[model samples]
Target chain A: MFEVRIHSRGGQGGVTAARLLALAAVRDGKYATAFPFYGAERRGAPVVSFVRIDDAPIRISSQIKKPDLVIVLDPSVMDVVDVLQGLKPGGRVLLNARERRDMKGYPTFTVDLTGIALREKLEVAGSPILNTPVLGALAKMGIVTMESAKSAITEMFSDPRNVSAAEAAYRELVA
Target chain B: MLTVATGNKAVAAAVKEAAPAVVAAYPITPQTEIVEQIAEYVSSGELKSQYIPVESEHSAMAACIGASVTGARTFTATSSHGLHYMHEMVNWAAGARLPIVMANVNRALGPGWNIWAEHTDAFQERDSGWLQVYVGSVQEAFDAVLMAFCIAEDERVLLPVMVNLDGFLLSHTMQPLEIEKAGDFIPPLHLPHAIDPQNPCGYGTLTGPDDYFRLRWDIERSMRDAVDVIRGTQERFARRFGRKYGMVDEYRCDDAEVVIVAAGTLGREAEVAVDLLRDEGTRAGSMRIRWFRPFPRLDLSGRDVVVIDRDYSFGFGGVLAKSIAATEGARPFSVIAGLGGQEVTYEDIAGFVRNRQPGRELWFGVNGDV
Candidate 1:
């Protein structure tokens, strides 16, 4: 099983990112489950969601303690939360950043998801939509096929810009 | 359609397919999504049902009972405090032999005010004559709701059924689901005692002691009959939808010396624990009890039992552990865990089995008390 934990603020669509990733995994013919760790969260409060993908039917319902991958949708949340608290030894990290930062030793991938969303004009309210674009980064990292990821995004969202933003992130990601 | 959905959404989808005539519900946290989705379906003209947004859970159930007695298929959903608030109407729906189907998102009842996953809310309703089935996954939640209507409306068992899913844990969890057309699987409800305006019969009035005693007996008799009804409905459902369900979901129990017994999501997680113990050569198995009201006959006479109960009976003990002891006549190591959505992982479950002490109870995270 491949387990992932996503860190972001409450209203930043971290939960939806987890759902879209799981849906893409399902579309790729694997079993997947996604859920948010709901707390007394309001907008901008650091929140997390989990996703699990496996070859067989996923039976366990407990929260992931040691994730194989950790995704940071908002770099600001790293100040309040330890995104890599229970990451497995030599686990990978995916961050939504304009430029890469030095990590201890883990292989890190970076994507300017916010910049891509803004470029594609996928802003909701005032925040650039990071969740949809982040899927492209995940797909580029081989977490899912680009076709499956784009299909998953289109299945949930009718807006064509969400798909375009993902395509932009896929091309601009720095692995 | 193959898609990913939350447990609440799956229940709403099944309810929509069942095409209930009336859906009277009051929104409660965790369970609110189900009513919200159903109301959207009603508004979008996808589901043709009278959606009643009531003031309280009591009114929600009362409205369902009123509509159900009029031979209209009725549905409702509620959670912890909301379920307790409708305690009167819940029993009334069952006692009146109304085939009302309800989806209960099991949540913790509170003085501390929690909205997390727990089974005590539905556990307390065990004797209300409502057939209860706790689902472990989003797909099971969908399938159980579809089956609940058929089993409840069966002429042999004209009683309400409550399909339960753990709040937040299962209710909010998104999983791959295959939605099927429930075409003719749930035969149109034929309520024999439906209120007829032409005949104009009186019901629910004061009854004499003798008839009241018989009425109570009738509920019990039908309760016994429900076991067969549940089995037949499940069998037919499997034939139609290609998914089968049993009274208890067993995993690696065939050649095990010790078995962990549980219900709801905890029960599903136990399977992983069983696999871990087996890797260490401990011969562990899991039996997830699905039906709670007409409790199934478990075959645990020769195995050492480790029963995990998410709900406690306060002064008595863990309800599930006591139930296993009473029915199977075997002493079990009772573990009380996961109350108010305390995280009980597969590793913790495996540890419980490794430190098993028979005829004893251990409360996880509450040190020093056995």
Candidate 2:
């Protein structure tokens, strides 16, 4: 089973990204489950969402304690929360950051997801929605293909620019 | 066709397939998506039903009862405080012999305000005369909701059925669900005691001690009879859909000396713990009690039974442990765990098995005394 944990603030589409990832995996003929750790239901609160993908049925319903990959949608969240708390050894980090930061362990991929969202004009009420672009970065990990991710984004969001944002992030992802 | 869906969406899809005559809508966290989807179905003409927008959860159940009395197949969904708000009507729906089906997303009832998965909300309604079935998976949530209507509408069991799923655990968690058309298995609902305008008879009228006692007995008799009706319904569903469910789902229980008994998602996790224990040569098994209402008879005769409950009864103990001990007459190693959606991993359950002792209630992961 491949478990991925996504960290972001509320109203930033963290849960949407998790669901899109699961839907993409399902579209690709694999079993997947996505759910959010619902804390305070207000905007700007730190939120976490999880996705589990596997060949067989995923049975365990507990939160992802040891995630195979961690996707951080908001770079500022790193100061407040431990985004890499339960990352397994040799696991990868997909960060929506401006610059690549060297970590002792694990392969880290940094993408300017906010910049990409701004460039693509993917903003809701002036705040850049970075989850879609972060999902594109997540696709680079090979857990879900870029094509499947784009299709899922299109299926979930009616706006055409969201697909463009995902595609752009998929191309602009850097390690 | 198989599709990826959260438990809430699966339930809404199942309800749509059932195509109830009326659906009362009141939004609550983890449960809101269900009624939201149902409302969408109703609005889009996918499901031809009357969607009653109620102000509160209490009114939701009240509306269900009102619609159900006219012999309409009714459905509703609620969670946590919402379930508590509908507490009075919950009992009324059952006592009135209305075949109402409700999806209850089990959540923690709070003074501190929590919306996480917990069984306390559902467990509080144990005596309300509702046939309760706690489901573990998104698929089971859909299947149980479909089967609930059949069981409740049966002449032998004209009681409301509460399909309980863990809030945000099974409720919000997505999975691949294989949904069968409800018309294939469930026939049109037939309420024997429905109010007919032509008959001009009174319903739920005041009864003296003599008549009231018999009415209560009748409900009890029907509740007991519901056990067989539920099994038969599930058997027919299996034949049609090729998926079978039981009142109690046993996993690796045969030839095992130690067993962990649980309900909902905890039981699913315990199965993983059982496999891990067996790998280390410990004879362990997991028993998932599906139907909490009928409380299926379990054989823990020679096995060291461990009861893991997500809800407690304050003064007594874990609700499941008490129920099991009442029926099986064996003092189980009771572990109260996962209240307010506290994370309980399979490894935590394995630790419970390793240090289990009989005749004591151990609150798993509790910091200090009691």
Candidate 3:
């Protein structure tokens, strides 16, 4: 089984990214589940969402304490929350940042998701929606194919720009 | 075919398949999406029903009861404070013996204001004469809601059924759910004591000592008879859908010595814990009590039982553990966990089994000792 924990601010589409990832995995013929953990309904607050994928039915319902992968949609969340708290050894961290920073002991991948969102003009009320682009960079990890990710994004947003943004980030992802 | 959907969406899908005559909608967190989807189905002409957007939960249920009395198949959904707000109507819906089905997203009630998953919201209405079924999976949530209508509308058990699922845990969690079309498996609802204007009948008027006692006894008798109705309905549902569910789902319990008892999503976690314990060479199992209203008698004759409850009953022990102790004649080690949606992992569950004091109440993951 593969588990992922996503960190981002509310209204930034972290929950949507988790759902899209699960959808893509399921479309790829794998069992998947996704959910978010949030108390307040306000925007700009820290939000956490999770995704689990496996070949067989996933039975455990608890939150992902030890995630095989962690995706940070907003770098500012790093200061407020421990996004790497339960990251397993050999697990990878995908960040939506302009420049890569040292993540202590884990391998990190970087993508300018905000820049990609801006390039693709994916914004809602003046905030760049970075979920799709970050998911695109996550697709580089090979857990889900880029084509499946694009299909899932299209299934959710039904917009050509979302598919384009995901394709752009999938090509420009850097380690 | 299997499609991925949230638990709330699965419930809305099942309700749409049931094709109720009326749906009373009031929005609440985690539960809001269920009714919102139902409203969309009505607006899109996917489901033909009278959709009433009420002001509050009380009015939502009140409208369902009103519609149900006219022999209409009715449905509603609520959570946490919303369910508490509908306390009076909840009792009235059952006391009037209306065959109404409601989806209750179990959430923590608070002075501190929490909206996480907890069972206190539904446990408070235990004596309100409603048949409560707590579901663990998104698929089960859909199946249980479909079965609830059949059980409640039976001639022998004309009481309301509250289908409870953990808020956000099962409510918002996505899973591969197989939705069956409500065909001959669930027949049209026929209320034997409906308020018929053509027959000129009086309904729910004041009852004196001469008749009130007998009415209450009748409700109890129906509750007792509901156990068999639920089993038979589930059996018929399985025969049609090819998926069988029990009043209590047992996992790896055949040759085990230590068993963990849980409800809702915690039961799924306990099943994982049982596997982990077995890998470590400990004989452990998990039992998920699905129907809490007509509490099924479990055979825990020779097993060390550990009860994990998400809600506490203040003076008494864990509600499920106490019920088991009263019925099964065995004192269990009670553990109160997952209150207000505090994270309880399978590792913590295995630890509970290794460090349990029989016949004692242990509050797991609390700050201070009790």
Name the candidate that leads on lDDT.
1
lDDT of 3 by residue, B112-183 (tens): 788899999999999999999999999999999999999999999999999999999999998878878787
The DockQ score of candidate 3 comes to: 0.70
Q: How does each model score on TM-score?
A: 0.99, 0.95, 0.95
Model 2 C-alpha lDDT per residue in residues B1-370, reported as the tens digit of each score: 7767889999999999999999996999879999999999999999999999999999999999989988999999999899999999999998899999999999998877888888989989998889999999999999999999999999999999999999989988888888777766778887876777667865558889999899899899999999999999999988988888999999999999999999999999999899999999999999999999977999899999999999989889999999999999978989999998989999999998998888888888764224
Q: Give the per-residue lDDT of model 2 (tens digit) for A115-151.
A: 9999999899999988677667767767788888887
Which clashing pairs does model 1 show? Answer: none
Q: Quick one: ranking by TM-score, best first?
A: 1, 3, 2
For TM-score, the strongest prediction is 1
Chain A of candidate 2 gets a TM-score of 0.95
Candidate 1 residue B190 Cα shift, in angstroms, is 0.5
Candidate 1, CAPRI quality class derived from DockQ: high
Clashes of 1: 0
lDDT-wise, the better of 1 and 3 is 1
